[model samples]
Target: MPATIRDVAKAAGVTIGTVSRALNNYSDVNCHTRERILRVAQELGYRPNQMARSLSSKHSKNIALVLSGFLEDTMLNDFETMLMKGIYQFAFEHGIDIAMYVINSRTQKEKSYEQLCYEHNIAGAILFGLKTNDPYCEALAASHRPCVTIDTEVRGPCISNVTLDDVTAFDELTQYLIDRGHRKIVLVHGRKNAMVSMERLVGAYQAFTRNGLTLTHDSIIYTNFLREEAVAGVGAYFRTHTPDSATAFLCMSDMLAIGTIEALKSLGYRVPDDYSVVGYDGLEVANYTDPKITTVDQNIKEKGYEAAHLLYDMLNGIRPAQKLVLPHTLVERESVKNLNELSN
Candidate 1:
């Protein structure tokens, strides 16, 4: 076993308290006793407990990245992986200790947001995947600690929100379809109480209205942001309303688009030729299909980077806290067809 503080104290012929004070460089300890403790600690290969040490300090340097999903599901997705990479990179570069915690909606019923922070000894937090109905969201708004929420529209006095313009992105996407002569488009969306979903719905409506087209309420399908759920939900949806129901499917996520393609294929349909598709989030898997999906690259990694920066700045008092919107680009691939040319 590695050396503990007890081992060092024994070797140095001092109490554990004296050994701890000497190792932590407390001034009250005599210089001779501190030197002896440190030398004995080195000889015994004693390393301080980081978690214990953090708890002891008044100003803990530890922060947490609060992700909202099961640990397995969170790591499996490309968006989450890329986001974590950006967050971890920032923490590493800044000499910050980052703790990762997953608190799904169900877990929030048992533990409050503040309780999680308290248990983890977190000084600040970067949160992601909180929907509108989360119970902790109310507490989060009232929190005095530094926090940055990623990709959500929720606002608070101290909480910084990092996201791209979801409304504008979806607006341009719908307009892109309308420009290409694609009318009667189906909008595949995420769950209810999702702020982003609401924003995207607004964008789609705005685009359709501006072009003198009506986006009827029946045209939207809610799938709750999972591929398997999307597959079953979309499959059942189109079964009731045939492929001719819409010429294109404008999905709020790549997973939804991919699932739509699968659901359509199982019913003996081809993408773009039979029904055009456009997805949000530029995931690599979206490109693996026979016809690559057109998508919006919303800079998810940069959102993580900005979230870290925002929370750190708030904690350090380096800058005032506010919403940070990052840039996004539309990637046009082989998914959406040019219906105008076909009409000619």
Candidate 2:
């Protein structure tokens, strides 16, 4: 038989009410006392009755992690996987229950965000992969249910948007290229529907404008956030433009940058010698690549942790800032070559 809350209270030498508050994660509980109670509860094998807790408290302590339009065949990449790890760890530590759902276009037509939340008794949600024009995004923007999105901006009564500082990171990265004497830079961007891609494009453009450089529309290449797409896009670009035409390629993702490098190698061109390259979302795989990749590290795990905490705050009636832009850093690797070094 499982130990009861009374047993946990006795073991911790605290009142039943104190044990209850601590178990429920009440902010007012003393930190030391809460820790003690949790430790005692774990030792005593005390599990809170979810139904009873829900009945006593008006709000459900459940959160849903929704991944929108995730393809079944596609492998779960590092970003989403790391984000999920953070959210799962946070939820486990805070005693908040979490559920996951993958919604496709068909599901979007059949169920609304509110309905899903209601059906699952979810207090809030951490959402991902939503495009600006998605039907679910429209509903999420209109709904008052507390929702936190990664890299996508949505504003509502209880919505919180969390992501890395894309604009600043990209701007700094582009400026780095310009400082390295890269005059002709190619921008390999993600799909147009992704807001993050658009923000990155804006930042890259700003860097060029501030540096007194002109970028034509032809300098931009679009990809569907796929390595294969990047290979095709870069390959097509080289077919028309000379292999050495551009001094550098700034890709929106590490995969794209790796793909660009692979494409260049296939054409008998070398990286940082024939053309420098930089990538975003500094994934671990980038480090394993030959020459490695220079990229903006977005701290994917931290994004997930913060997103969960933000939703927890909202659930507790604390209105966090409308948008939280996490810090990003430029991870310098061997992919980019300084022309100044060549001159020297």
Candidate 3:
């Protein structure tokens, strides 16, 4: 027979109410006592029936993780894989199950979100790819349901969010290039509607202005973060402008950088020797490039881990912060070269 709460209480030498409080992570429970109860429960292999617990506590025992679009995009797919791995690992340990939802413009308008929530009986949600002006965000807030956004912003009511300091990171990266004596820099940005893309573009411009440099409209190009798009965009930009026009390229993602690098090689442009490149997202593939990409490491796996843990806390009645910002670092690699030395 499966171990019961009463059995755990007896094993821990605590009252049933005390066991309940400890299991629920109530603040009133003594830390030591709670630890003891947890230890005892583990020793006896006590697995709480999530369904029964939900029925008793008026919770749905289901949480939703919503992505921005379909899994066709390589960058998004990679992020989803890493994020889901972390989320599932944490959820498994905590006896929670995740219901994943992929929301696009079509689904958002087709009653899919509501149908998903109802079908899964989700008590809370974790949303990714929230646009700045997303109307669904407002509806989720108005519903008074606990939700968290990953790599996006959620405002008003009981919503929480986690994102990187994208602007600061981009600024620091661009400044690093400038400090290394790169005067002519090109930017390959992602979708315009993405908050991250807008912030990064703003940071790039700000970095140039702060250093008494000017950015022409032709200095920046936009792509949909697709490999083919990256290749075509960079190739087209270079075809129109001379190699001396820009000494370096700052890509919004490593995948884009890979595409740009391939395009450059096809045009007889040697990386770092003729042009330097930097990318964001320190994916494993970044290192595999001919000259390993210099990038901003956002620790994607950790982001997912933190998101899952935050949701778990919210489910247990712990009110976490409204906004969580993860830290990022610059990974210097061979792809970025000092233009001053090359010029000499």
Q: Flag regions of model 1 displaced more than 4 Å.
A: 1-59, 71-75
Q: What digit string (tens of lDDT, one per residue) describes model 2 on residues 145-246?
A: 788999999877778999877888899999999999898999998879889998998899899999999878888888878888888988899888975679
Clashing pairs in 2: none
RMSD in angstroms between candidate 2 and the native structure over all alpha carbons: 12.5
lDDT of 1 by residue, 1-344 (tens): 87998988888899999987766556688866865775576567565777456564544556899988646352278888789888988988987778888889888765667556654666789988888888768878877778998877566778888888889999999999999999889888887687888888888889998999997777887777777777787787776786677899899998889888888888788888888989998887877876899999987777788889888899989977798888889999999988999879
**Top candidate when judged by TM-score against the true structure:** 1
Compute the lDDT of residue 311 as modeled in candidate 3: 75
Candidate 3 C-alpha RMSD relative to the actual structure: 12.5
Clashing pairs in 3: none
Full candidate order by TM-score, most accurate first? 1, 2, 3
Question: lDDT tens digits, residues 1-344, model 3?
Answer: 87898999999999999988777667788867876786687678665677345443434467888886655475544666777787788888877778787777655644434334543466678888766666576566655567788876767566778789999999988998998899899888887788889888888889999999998888888887777788999889977997789989989888888888998898999998888999997787888889999999988888887888887787678875488899998999999888667567
| Of candidates 3 and 1, the better by lDDT | 1
**Candidate 2 deviant stretches above 4 angstroms:** 1-60
Please, what is the TM-score per model? 0.82, 0.80, 0.79
